[model samples]
Target: MVTKESWSMSIWPMAPWKITFLIYQREKLLWIGIQMKVAAGAAKGLEYLHETADPPVIYRDFKASNILLDAEFNPKLSDFGLAKLVQLGIKTHVSTRVMGTYGYCAPEYALTGQLTSKSDVYSFGVVFLEIITGRRVIDNSRPTEEQNLVTWASPLLKDRKKFDLLADPLLEGNYPQKGLHQALAVAAMCLQEEAATRPLMSDVVTALEYLATNKDAGQGGILEEPEEGEEDHIEADS
Candidate 1:
């Protein structure tokens, strides 16, 4: 439990679930602006580890479930068992056995066992996509065509005409069109197939900060507070 003068945070303990579960709750919806705020906070946490740390750290297991939220929806990245420190000037990537959630791994890292900041970028893209579409990275219950979110959304992202289809339906068309376009563009850049093409976490932080601060990005809606005695934990899966 974390506390401040104004509010306290109780970490919710659940497995294989994510921020989306809370954001898309049936009773109350977390507005897009708030979601952007959480995203920016999480990105800043990652930026700190990747750029500010003495030895740049690779958050190899970044995902939504690993992001903890306080009473005000501030995000904190949790779970460092899979984190790796890079000798920035010496090595380009860490050679380790493939690990992390299946759907969130970067394609190159998954194939080569080469872990880097870009791998974390890929994972962030998946989580960001979840925030935008309110869908899981992989959902067996969904139709085969729509089961893999990145794959399903990839084509739609290319066509501006189909962009509206990407927003979380629970949002009920409450989000701003321009904001949705910008958000999807960020996700697409991070999800780039080539690790070298992905934007740095710093760039992501800058973009999300703008989106988060602009209340016009999404219509305000009710925000959900974490229930007492519930905390979320993210455990890496091989």
Candidate 2:
């Protein structure tokens, strides 16, 4: 038998997707700094679930629609229907029926029905990419070549020279190049085809916090090149 609990959370005026849709209607992207803050808050929440909870929880469904935004755009995670508590002990992963929104589920979990904290990390990465590119995870309206955000952007993400192409056109070339590089690096790590290679939510939080702080400080520079290993992997995969 399963039990459920209900608790109150202050109302959030919108979900990230709703906000994105609104901005899209205006042909604009959310300010990069605000995007960073939202990403940080969402990462912190996932970090708490995966690390601070008594029995670490795996948020099996993590996506933009599940992230609520207050009037000020602070992000709060919602919908725990697919959440699962990891059993205490040495088990590193929970074997379960594969369930989650497509285009967001980690490749490993989607293929093998294995669940872990990294599964959530992969979903977070997809949302992060959406925030950066101002595109949906899967948009069939786009040209067939660009319909799947990850499949289309994965190659672009590897080359610093092509990083500019990955930014949302709505940003109007206003975002900091250095910050874009850093953010893409973090996203690439989280979206690794090998789930084991994804960073922990805690590390993701720290990286995003730094980006948010630096963005507020008005930092700007040429984007850094990806590491040799990353470049090689991307090329090989492509």
lDDT value, candidate 2, whole model = 0.76
Candidate 2 C-alpha RMSD relative to the actual structure: 7.1
Candidate 1 has a TM-score of 0.81
Q: lDDT of all predictions, in order shown? A: 0.75, 0.76
Number of clashes in every candidate structure?
7, 0
Once model 1 is optimally superposed onto the true structure by TM-score, how far is the C-alpha of residue 190 displaced, in angstroms? 0.4
lDDT of 2 by residue, 3-67 (tens): 34754344545554444553345443344446777788989999999999877889999987888
Error of 1 at 153 (Å): 0.7
C-alpha lDDT (0 to 100) for residue 84 of candidate 2 = 85
- In candidate 2, list every pair of residues with a backbone clash: none
TM-score of each: 0.81, 0.81
Question: Which lDDT tens digits does candidate 1 get at residues 116-160?
Answer: 788888899999898878788888899999999999999987887
The alpha-carbon deviation from the true structure for residue 142 of candidate 2, after best TM-score superposition, in angstroms, is 0.5
Residue 175 lDDT (model 1): 50
